[model samples]
Every structure is written in structure tokens, then in C-alpha cells.
Target: MAETNSSDTRILMFPWFAFGHMTPFLHLANKLARKGYRITFAAPRKAINQLEPLNLFPDFISFHPVTVPSVTGLPPGAETASDIPISLSRFLATAIDLTIDQLKSLIKSISPKLIIFDTAHWIPQVAKPLGIKTMCFKVVSASSIALVLVPARNIPTDRPVTVEDLASPPPGYPSSSVVLRGKELQTLLFVTNPFGDGLTFHERITMSMKNSDVLAMRTCHEVEGNLCDYIGSQYQKRILLTGPVLPEESKSTLEERWGNWLARFEPGSVVFCAFGSQIILEKTQFRELVLGFELTGLPFLMAVKPPAGTTTIEEALPEGFEERVKGRGVVWGGWVQQPLMLAHPSVGCFVNHCGFGSMWESLMSDCQIVLAPHLGDQILNTKLLADELEVAVEVKREENGWIPKENLSEAIKLVMDKDSEVGKLLKENHNKWREIINPKLVNEYVDKFVQSLHEVVG
Candidate 1:
């Protein structure tokens, strides 16, 4: 145990409300559980239930749920870090104060040694005065990190909108594996400093990690060694490449589900499509996607998000679209067990928004990708996963900044086409990756992460 005893080291992990943000932090909380660290994870009471299965979350770790007020303009019933809106600024303006108040009250009930946070960098402001150390547990792609800090064009500069010199070698990384795309740009934006807020915010975030203490990632160096090393040097912080923190239970369930689903199909057949949680599609756009997917003449399972901000699935769906595709497709209105869905044997390819966490999860689960990235750093991740790794194909984009139905359909067909080279290579890589990454997930990924904590507080 780190700290004074097995029961003493308590982590106060406050993840953002988006499911993507919550994914890695909770996996980390569970890892800490195996190591005997007590935890009081603070978030709205509404959000904790989705993570209920994690209740087996070891003997040492425990949850502390808080209620977020029903504020206007956010999602209805929105409660915790995982349910908050995607607007970084607006969400932060509301969430920071509420989260601090919630945490402060929770702290009165249980004081702990460390506080790990993601999304909102303002957490250090609240934790520092309390004598609690804060670790910025940002969910990022290691390749994206390398590409961002490589003395790129328009990076960290006023009036610098385009990324340049991103093709430069990622520092502390093997050059042979380093790669970037011609049109793709790296992200200089982040949770707190999305449009160059100021040197103050970046300095605050970077300074928080000046220590040799772990600046862990949601990746494993074994799979992305060059990218990992590049990040460590760029951030100037100790790097821990912990693989994607996924639900352990979901893995078993997926094996069962996939085994069953595969029974209904030939080997190497279905295509899986899902935009991660927090993506709200317009009704018109949703209808177009349905048309595209149906036209591809491939078996698919889509985890669809309901419309937010005056949009709804029923309104967006094509007339009788659900009925026509009845037995062939399954579309859900909310979050699905993503990793499990992707890893199914029947699933040969994945369509994603290029969220790094989703990308890593798909790769780890042995699913080839058909990427359709929208806003945020997803564009950056798509560049790395689609262009650099070459394990995925980019969905064609429209002049309007989104892929039309035709392009989307074409991309999926290419990725899943039995006779296409892209499909063949992706399938080969998928099997190889499944073999390579499994050992880390089961054998040593979580253990190394826990070891770092024990070393720190012991």
C-alpha cells in the first residue's frame, strides 16, 4: 500500500461528465482498487449507476456520488461528469463550481492523499490549498501528443490556425514508426485552453506535472512505444502507458455475445458503427447515415445517440427505415457496451468519430476502422489512425465538413469489401493486434500502474 497503510491512501478522482472522459479514469480507479487504495470518486448521483458493475471495484476503493442541480440548457437529468455537455467552456463554467462544492463536502466526510482529475484543469486551484496533490489524467492518443508538440505549424502561435512541421520526428521515439498525414493537423487545444486561453492555463497544467510523478496515458508503450516516448518528452513528465481502461465485465459478456453472433455468420463478416457518447447528430444527418449504411449491403450494428438540441431519432430516421432493416441491424438510442460490441467476431469493421479512446478501444478489441471524424481533436486522431497506422480508412468529407450519405456508404463498403486490399490488411492486423494486446490487458497493464502509486506514497 502507498501512504501510511493499505486503508490510508485515498484517491479523489473527478472525471468530466462525458462518457469518454469517465471511461479511462474509472478504469484507473479500479486499478487502484487492486492495489489497496481507498477511493471516493465524486460525480453526480445520476452518473454512478452506469458504472455499477464496477462495484466489485476491489475492497479498498469506494464511490462518493453527488447530485448536480437541474440547470437549464444542459441535458435533461444530466447529473455527473459523464452526462455533461460537450461545450468545454459552458460545461466548465457550470461544472467547476458545482464539482468543487460537491468535492469539498465529500472531503469533509473523507480526506485522502491524492486527487486525480481530467477535463477541467481548474481542479488544481481547488486541490492545491487543501494540501492534496493533483494529477491531470488527460485521455489522449500518444501519437496525437507527439504530433502536437513537434514544432508544428500554427501551433502555440497567435494567428496560427494551421499545423506545420508536424511531420518532424516525435522526440524520444523511434523515427521509423513515426508518421503523419498531409492534410491532418495536430491539436493545440485542450480541456482548459481550447483556443489559446493564455500561457497561464498551459503553464498551470504543465507546471502541475513538473514533478517526476506519473503523467499516465490511456495507452500502452508496447503497442505504441514511439508515440509513448514522444509524449513523455513533450510533456516533460513521467509517462505511464496504461492501456484503455475498459469494463472488465464487458469483455466476458462480449466474448459470449460475439461467439453467439458469429454463429449466425461466416468468419470475418459484420460491420460495427458507433459514434462515442456525447455525439448529438442532427435529424437530417441521421437519416442520411441510415440510408448510407443500408445501401452498403453489409451486416451492421449501430449504437446511435438520440438527438439533443431539438433533434430526435424518430424525426431523423427515414420512413420505415427501422422496419426494413429489422433483423439485419440494431440501433440503440443511448450508450451501448462499446468495446464489447466492436470486438464481436461478427464485427469486421468499425465506424467511429475518431475519438482517441474509441480508436484505442477498437484497435485493442481487434476491429478494423471506418472513420468519420467531426469536431475537436477527433480530426487529429483520425489522421493518426487512418493515415499513419493505416489500420483504418477515412470516410470522405463533404464541403459542409461532414460526409454525405454517398461517401459514408462508399467508405464502409471499401473497408468491409472481401476483395479489397484495405479489408484484407485490416483483418490481418486485427488478429495480430488481438494476440499482442491481450497479454497487456490481462497480465501487466494494470499492475504497472498500481506499482507506480505504491512507489509514490510508500
Candidate 2:
């Protein structure tokens, strides 16, 4: 390889084939590009069009579209996890794995200073021979990594990992507050299941982290320092923090229809709920969730995907629900501008699935938080926000992980009620945290993170 100029060092970003992973990778790319570093972001060809508008620094950051070769059982044109149901994610993983040769060619041609990735565990091996350093940048919270992915969670060769094994944290795990309970333990079963070809999701991520030259997270030390430290100790690799990598302020405005709808409500009275792109609730659960919002008797705007086996949000609504909540509530099937909606003064309470990205967005906004986590990482994130930080409340769940409408209603009321002591305390704590995670502090983390990248590559 020809010697590259230090001033012209470019960083390559290749996240797993999922929107949750890819979106954060791009956010960090924007941050690095702002500091004058060029970034080459690689993702499926189809996803690039969707992600293009988010490329704020298009002059400094460019997209490389990788064609996902078809794999058995993978639906045609399903380039991302969002395109298919959760059950078929393994097929997407396999398809992404098949693109290794294309990626290797890209790496050889570009010869970037470093490659940052998650879940694509082969990156280090592929980049090492090309003289490119690799960083396994985890977009999920460090607490989730520490809780399950660390080396201490011994994978017994004699027997498969059972729910019993996940009931408590592994020995030397970082925090007691992040444990999973009841049916939530079932979510971790995917760790042991085959993700792509022969590798399980756990194997894939841990191998990526284990092989990378460095490990980093989209979090700051103030919130998860101990968890990050524990991961570092177990992996024996240096850990870099990116301080949540919050999105830059947008120049665009909320859509006029949404703006007009929200304007009808008083400030701090409307409840806005959004689960991330991946969650597709069952019909019963979907109806229960909307009914929960109605039971609160508060105006709400729910942006959710259609329920399983349903064609539209309207089809899944409980009988008489539309007429009952008619003018005060809206159940939107399509996407809504989440950050802008959260920023709207009328949106006082945010009920979210607690994905890491949404967690940061909620933390930065003025709205009171209500968590309804649907996955392993999300559950851990909920624990961090509700239990560890005490800045949010999680809705109560049954033994089967079903959230009753009454419980959801009560959780919302706990945060939205003006006179509730819990609501007051949560608001105060959230404000303090919002101040700590301000843009100034996040920029400082990015500064240090870039400095570390330079040192590693050099």
C-alpha cells in the first residue's frame, strides 16, 4: 500500500445490516466528518437511498453501496432487518456475510486509516492483512454488553445456555440493576441461536469485539462508566466513549399536519408514543397499548407499525376505539418525525420502546419518559433509564411479559400527573441528566474520540 497522508486519513464505517445499528454509525460518521475527517459509509444498496438525506456532511462523507447476495429463505430485496420479520434476521445476516469479498475489495482499494463496525466480526481479520486498524463500535448501551456478551458468561460446551443461566448476571458482571426477569429472559435466547451460517449472535458480536484493535461505545462515562470499565476489563481492550452521539439539530420543520394536530392541545398535555422500526406488536397488545393511552384520558399521538397479521393501524383498532377518542387521539401507521414531535411543546410525555437511540433522544428532550422495552438490549436500556438513572418509569409487565392496559395507563399517569411526587422527582433527575449530556459535553467526547482514533491509526 502507498503511504497515506496523515492529514487525509479516512475512516470506513460498516455497521451490521440493521437500521438500529446503521443509523448510529452514520451519526458518529457525521461527528467525525464535522472535525474534517472523511468517512466512507458502507451499507446495502437499497438502504443508502433512505440514509442519504441523513448524510449532513455529504461533501466529507460518501456512501458505498454493498449488494447483499441472496441467501436461502431471505425474501427478495430484503437488504435490511427492517425489511423482514424478526424470525428471518438470520437470513439477512447470512446475506450480509456473503458480501465479505466485496468489502475486502473495497478495503484494499480505499486503504482507510480505520474501519469501525459492529456484528461483522470478520472485519479485523479482513482489515489486518491490509494494514487497516479496526474498531468494534457498539451502538448499544455498555450495560447490555457487560450483562451478556462479556467473556465471563462462560458458554458451557456440555450444555446450552438456559434461561436459568441468564436469570442473574454472570460472575464479575458490572451492575446488579441490569438483570432480566420473567419472560424478558426469553429474549436472550437469540444469543445462543445461529445468526449467520454457523455463528450465533453472541459469537458474532463477541468475536468482533475480541478481534478488533479497539472497542468503543455510543455512551459517556458519566452514565455507564462502571459498565464500560467492566467490558474493558473482560475484553482487555481499550474502550472509547462517544457520549451518546446525539443527532445534530435539524434545519427542517415538523410536517404541517402534525404541527396542526399538536397545536390543538395545551403545552405539556399531549402524550407522544413511538416504538422503534423493528417492533411489530401482536394485535391484542397493539389494541391494549392504544387503549392504555385512551384510558389515561389524555390526548395522544401514537406512531406505531401495524400489528402482526393486520394491513393497517385502523384494522387493528379495538371496536369503538376510533369513535371514543375521535378528535383527541391519532393512531398513525406511517412514520412521524419523532425528534421534532418530542421537541413540540405539547408533547409532555414520551412512551418509547427504549432503544438506545430513542433513549438518548428522550434524555435530551423536555418530555417525561415511559419505557416499554421489547428486546434484550432495550430491556437493559429501560433498566438504565428507569432503575439506574431514576429518570423514567417502566410499565409493569405480567409473568408472560404482557403489559396490561391498566399498567401502561398507570405508568403514563405516574409521569404526567402534575401533583404526583414520582413525576416531580423524575422530571428533576431528567433535567439534571439533560444538562450533563448537553451538546457541549458530547462534542468534548467526540474530540477525545477522534484524538484516540488518530493515536491508534498512527
lDDT of each: 0.64, 0.90
Residues 13-91 of candidate 1: C-alpha lDDT, one tens digit per residue: 8776666776567777776675567887776565677765655554566667766655445566666433554563354
Can you give the TM-score per candidate against the true fold?
Answer: 0.81, 0.97
lDDT of 1 at 194: 41
By TM-score, how accurate is candidate 1? 0.81
* Runs with alpha carbons beyond 4 Å of true place in candidate 2: 1-6
lDDT score, residue 266, model 1?
55
lDDT, candidate 2, 207-267, per-residue tens: 9999999999999999999999999999999999988887778888999999999999999
* TM-score for candidate 2, residues paired by index: 0.97
